[model samples]
Target: MIELRSLTKNFEDKKVLRGINSVFEGGKCNLIIGRSGSGKTVLMKCIVGLLTPTTGNVFYDERDFCVMTKRERTLLRREMGMIFQSAALFDSLTVLENVMFPLDMFSDQSYKERTRRAKYCLERVGLLDALSKSPGEISGGMQKRVAIARAIALEPKYLFCDEPNSGLDPKTSLVIDELIYSITQETGTTTIMNTHDMNSVLGIGDHILYLHEGEKEWEGTKDEVLGSTNERLSDFIFASDFLKKVKAAGAKS
Candidate 1:
C-alpha cells in the first residue's frame, strides 16, 4: 500500500498540491481523476519519484520514499513499474525485446531466462502473436498492450499507469482496463492510475481520488460517486447531459 501524509508541492511561487492525504491499497485499481490542470498528473509524478514533494511523506509499504538515499531509491524503483500516456515502446525493438529491456537492464538472469520471463509477460497481456512485431507495425491498442507487458516484465510490486487508455477506442479501452485490473489483483501489486477516463473510473476504480486545484476534493468507490454531495465533484462528473441522465436513472432505480 502507498500512503500520502500531508503532501504538498510547489513550483516557484505557485503551489500545485496542498496537504493531500490518501492511501492507495494494494491488489486494487486505485484511480486518480480530475479535469485538466487539476494537479492529478503532478501527484502521480510525485508518488513515482519523478518529482519530489515540497512537504509531506510518501510511504510505500511503510518505507518513507522521500528520505531514501540515491542508492536506496534506485533499488526501490526496481520494485516499481510505469506505463506512460503513450505506449512509449522503443521503435527499433521488437515487442518481445522491448519487454525484455527491463530484465536486461536490472537482472543478472541469463539471456534464456530473461527471454522466458519476457515471453510470459507478453502472453499475459495477450500479445503472444505480436512478439516479433515492431511498435510501428502494430495498432495503437496493441502497442499499449506491449507497453503493459514491458511494465510488468520485472514482476514489479508497485505499478503506475498514466492514462493507459488514452487515444484508444472505448471497446479497446475497456479491454486495457480489465487487463490492468486483473493483473493488479493477480499479482497483488499496489496499482495507481492517473486518468481522465470516466469509463475507466466506473469500470475499475476500486478506489477513487478526485482532485480539484491541487486539493484532494473527494475519495470513494465508484458506487459512492453517484451519491456524492460534493458540488464541485458533481459538477465535474455530471457536466454532460448523458451522465446527468445516467445519474437520474440510477437514482430512480
Candidate 2:
C-alpha cells in the first residue's frame, strides 16, 4: 500500500500538484485519472520518486520514502516494477532477453536462475512462443505484453503502469486491462495506474482518484463514479456522447 500526505509539487512558480492526499491499497487496481494538464502524471512521478514533492510525504507500505537516502532509495526501487505509456521495449533485444534485463542488472542469482525466472514471466503473460522475436517484429499489443512480462519478471511488490492501454484497439485494450488486474490480485501488488482511458476506469478501477487543476477533486470506486454529483467530474467523465448515453441509460434502468 502507498499513502500520500499533503503531496505538492511546484515547477518554479507553477504548481503541478497541490496537497494531494490519498491511499492506494494493495491487491487492487488503484487508478489516477484526469483530463490533460490535471497533474496525474506529476502525482505518479512524485509517488514513484521520479520527482520530489515540494512539501509533502510519500510513504510506501508505511516507510517514509521521502526521507530515504540515495542508497536506500536505490534498494527500494528494486522492489518496484514500471510500465511506460509506450511499451518501451528495446528493439535490439529479443523478448525473453528484454525480460531478463532487470534480473541481470539487479538480481544476485545465477544466470540459469535469471533465465528460468524470465521464461516463467513470459509464460505467465502467454508469450512463451515469441521469446526469440525482437520488439520490432511484434504488434503493438504483443509489445505491451512483453513489457508487462518484463515488469513482472522481478516479482515486484509495487507495480506502476502509465497508460498501459494506450494506442491499442478496444479488444486489445481489454486484454491488457484484464491481464494487469489479474496480476495485481494474484500477486497482491500495490498497483497504481495513471490513465485517461474511461474504459479502464470502469473496467478495473478498484479505487479511483480524480484530479482537477493540480488538486484531488474526488476519489471513489468505479461503481460510485456514474452516480457522482460533482459537476466537473461528471462533465469530464461523460465528455463523449456515447458515455452520456450510457449514463442516461443507467439512470433509466
Candidate 3:
C-alpha cells in the first residue's frame, strides 16, 4: 500500500499540492480524481517518486522515499509499473518488442525466456493476435491494452495508471477499467489510477481521493461518495450533465 503524509509541492511560487494525506489500498483500484490543473497529476507524480515533495513524505510499503539515496530510489522504482496517459508505445516496435522492452532492460533472463514472458503478457491483455502489429496498426483501445501488457511485464508490486481510459468510448473505457481491476486482484498489486472520469470513479474505484485546487477535499469508497454531503464534492461530481441524468434516472426507479 502507498501512504501520503502531509504532502506538499509547488511549481515556482505556485502551490500545486497542499498537505495531502491518504492511503491507497493494496490489491484494489485506488483512484485520484480532479479537474485539469487541479494538482491531480502532481500528486500522482509525487506518489510514484517521479516528483519530490517540497515539504512532506511518501511512504511506499513503509519506506519513506524522501530520505532514500538516488541509487536507492532507482532500485525502489524498479518495483513500480507505470501506464502512461497515451499508452506511450514505441511506433517502430512490434507488440511483442514493446512488451519485451522492460524485461530486457531490467531482467537477466535469456532471450527465449523473455519472448515467452512477453507473449504471456500480450495474451493476458487479450492481444495475442497483434504480436507483430506496430502501434499504428491498432486502435486506441488496443494500444491501451498493449500498454497494460508492457506495464505488467515487470510484475511490479505497485501499478500506476494515468488516465487509463482517456480517449476510448464508454464501452472501451469500461473494458480497460475492468482489465486493470482484474489484473490488480489477480496479482495483488497496489493499483492507483489518476482520472477525471466519474464513470471510472463509480465503476472501479475501490478507494477514491478527491482534489480541489491542490488540496484533498474528500475521500471514501464509491458508496460513500454518492451520499457525501460535501458541497464542493457535490458540485464537482454532479456538475456533469451526464451524471445528473444518471442520478435522475436512478431516482425514478
Clash counts per candidate, in order, are 0, 0, 0
lDDT tens per residue, model 3, 164-224? 8898899999989989999999999999999877888998889999999999999998888
TM-score of each: 0.97, 0.97, 0.96
Question: Whole-model lDDT, candidate 1?
Answer: 0.94
What overall lDDT goes with each candidate model? 0.94, 0.94, 0.92
lDDT of 2: 0.94
lDDT of 2 at 197: 87
Q: What would the per-residue lDDT of candidate 2 be over residues 1-253, giving only the tens digit for each residue?
A: 9999999999999999999999999999999999999998899899999999999999999999999999999999999999988889988899999999999999899999999999999988889999899999999999999999999989999999988888999999999999999999999999999988899999999999999999999999999988899998999999999999998998899
Winner by lDDT between candidate 3 and candidate 1: 1
Q: Name model 2 segments beyond 4 Å from true.
A: none
Worst 10 residues of 1 by lDDT: 194-203
Candidate 2 lDDT trough over 10 residues, lowest sum: 83-92
Worst 10 residues of 3 by lDDT: 242-251
